[model samples]
Target: MIFAYNKAHVGDVLMILVKNDNGADVTSTRCGNVTKIALKETNEVVAWNIFQASEMLGEISGVGQVVLSDEQIALLNEELAKEGFREVITQEKNSKFVIGFVKELTPHPDSDHLNIAQVEVDNGEMLQIVAGAPNIEQGQLVVVAKVGAMMPNGLVIWDGELRGVKSSGMMCSPRELQLENAPDVRGILVLEEGSATIGEAFSPEKHWHG
Candidate 1:
């Protein structure tokens, strides 16, 4: 689930994206201030538009992909119940960007330039990521943008396939992270030894001028 609010550009509305519709036909049903967007074929809820969101959720401040607290999710559920929608909101608590240690690396079967990597984040949790950075190597500590991350350019990361292989996340470069003074070159950002603990959230502020 992804929640975004941009009062300056989008007004007092909260946009919720629950699932990708995959270009399927969709329908919107509005009840009061809540509009449920669903896939027409299966009637699966895919997104939502909550108008006057601040009045109900209280002071939602963010440009994109705002994380919702459990309390706020409960409030949203209450509103959904009032409108008779059966879906309930759930809080996704994982950090979108984190430090990852590349545990394995191998050549992609179908793509010569792409590589398949097994990155470890969140202690023992592992993610299969396909990367194209020339500098990517096994046993390196790099930044991993997990599924559901909103990049600096407003791109949302999602589970995808690269060259017929499933990829769950991304290996980021400084340029992609929008770090200040990022080198005008191509490669994944490699962290110095002991600079950060594996699985910890990656703070862009620390690397703005690094």
Candidate 2:
């Protein structure tokens, strides 16, 4: 789940992103000050727009990617109920950016440059990623941006396929992470051995600088 609020630019509204519609057509339904956006065909809710949000949830501070507390989530549910909407929002507590260990790498059968990687991100949680970084190698410690990560450029990572291969996450480059003094070149950022614990959240402030 992602929440965003910018009173000055977007008015006193709260934007809640529940899921991506994958460019599918959508329909919007409004009840009171709340608007629910859903897929037109399946009616699966994808997002919500709450007008006058500050009046109910108090003033939210931030222009993008605002973090809400558990209390705030409950309040949002209450508001949804009041508006006769059955959908409920939940808080996502896990970090989407973390360190990963590449356990295996193989050439993609359908792609010339892309390589399929079996990466161990969390304890016993392996993800198949398609990386094109020429410098990528097995046994490397690298940054992994899992599905649902919101990049610095406002791009939301989602489960995707590459060249007929299923890829669950991304091997991030310094440029993709918007790191300070990122190299003007191609290749994923490789972390030094013992630099960080596998599966731990990656903090650029502590790990990288110009």
Measured by TM-score, the strongest candidate is 2
Residue range with the least summed lDDT across 10 consecutive positions in model 1: 201-210
lDDT of candidate 1 over 20-90, digit per residue (tens): 67688999999999999999988999899999998998988567879877778889999999999989888
Residue 135's lDDT within candidate 1 is: 96
> What TM-score does candidate 2 get on C-alpha atoms?
0.93
Q: Tell me the spans in candidate 1 whose CA falls farther than 4 Å from its real position.
A: 206-209
Model 2 Cα lDDT, one tens digit per residue, 91-164: 78888899999999999999889999999998979999998999999999999998877777777788889988
Off by over 4 Å in 2: none
Displacement of residue 15 (Cα, Å) in model 1 is 0.8
With a 3 Å backbone cut-off (N, CA, C), the pairs that clash in candidate 1 are none
